[model samples]
Target: MTFDATFWALIGLILFLALMIYIKIPGKIAEGLDKRSDDIRTELEEARRLREEAQALLAEYQRKQREAEREAEDIISQAQREAKAMATEAKAKLEAYVTRRQKQAEDKIAQAEAQAVQDVRTRSVDVAIQAAEIIIADKVSGKLADELIGKSIKDVAAKLN
Candidate 1:
């Protein structure tokens, strides 16, 4: 039989396959594919683990945010309470100041009234003494006048003291 291109090509293809089998190329290829698959599985597992860690971190941050909010609210409440207390204290101080001023004014008024009463009493006493002296001068002799004037002076001084 004459060897043709198709027959030779078929023979070459068979030889190439037999050479590959003799060298265990198929087994090596299977092993390479299995190693690649295992690597992909490991990467997938690592990605899953990273996703879980990220979720835990997210939860921790959320808890922290809630705690911050609570603390802020507490601070605000405390500030409000302190403000109210300050207002009450200020009001009390203002009331006490008003009372003290009113008391001082009353004391001043009382002092002025007392001074006026004393001045009036002094003026009345001087007027009465002048009237008595004029009457005594009109009615009494010199000796009797002197004796009466001395006794009146002594009596007036005693009453004043």
Candidate 2:
């Protein structure tokens, strides 16, 4: 009997299926797909691990940076306090120096005033002694008068000085 095109096509389809089954191409394909899926899953896990590691490193760096900033701020505040203390100390020293200098100047002035008073008193005593000698010489003119005058002058000099 002579078959139509449909019969030959059906035969071709069956032979192709048999040939593919004999070669185990479907099983190999399935195995290949499973292996590829496993490889993709492993790559995804590795990428996820790397991402987590990067995030952890980022967090650690951020923490360290924050600590460094805090330390820097603390150091700055400490320096400011030290500067204020130093300024206060310097001010105290300056005030002490100024007071000391003022006291020294006052002492010098007092010394000058005392010296002036002493000089005036010494000049007055000398003038009084000279006037007394002139008056006595004019009033007395004998040897006894000269001896008494010398004795009086010595007594006056001793008492005045």
Candidate 3:
């Protein structure tokens, strides 16, 4: 038989495949690929768990923020109501003070007016008595003067009464 190039190439290919099988290289490659796939799956599961935990924390913080906002509003509303009540009470107190001062001033004025009227009446009475004494001294003499003076005094007292 004559040896050819194609026949020799075929024989070389068969010998190479036999050497690979004897060494178990295909089984080792399959095992390495399977381990890499399992690592990738574990990493994906860990990433999913971390994402869920982050989402839950964000939701709890949001709820706390809403509660804080409501508490702030309530505090502001209560402060406003207290301020309004204080203002109303202050206004009432101020009005009462003004009214009391006004009444006191009026009473003082009335007392002053009454005192002035009394002074005028007393002055008039003194002037009248002096005039009567001067007229009686000029117009009469002795016992007749005394009698006229006594009669005039009685008439003036009765009229005053």
Best by lDDT: 1
TM-score of each: 0.83, 0.81, 0.64
Instruction: Give a tens-digit lDDT track for model 3, residues 1-161.
Output: 98899999999998988888889888888888888988999999999999999899999999999999999999999999999999999999999999999999999999999889878876776788778878988988899988987888787767765
> How many clashes show up per model?
0, 0, 0
User: Which lDDT values do the candidates have, in the order given?
Assistant: 0.95, 0.93, 0.88
lDDT of 1 at 156: 83
Model 2 poorest 10 in a row by lDDT? 124-133
Worst 10 residues of 3 by lDDT: 152-161
Could you give me the TM-score of model 2 versus the true structure? 0.81
Question: Per-residue lDDT tens digits of candidate 1, residues 101-160?
Answer: 999999999999999998988887788788988999899969999999889978887897
Q: Please give the distance, in angstroms, between residue 146's alpha carbon in candidate 3 and its true position after superposition.
A: 12
lDDT of 2 at 69: 100
- Model 2 RMSD in angstroms: 2.5
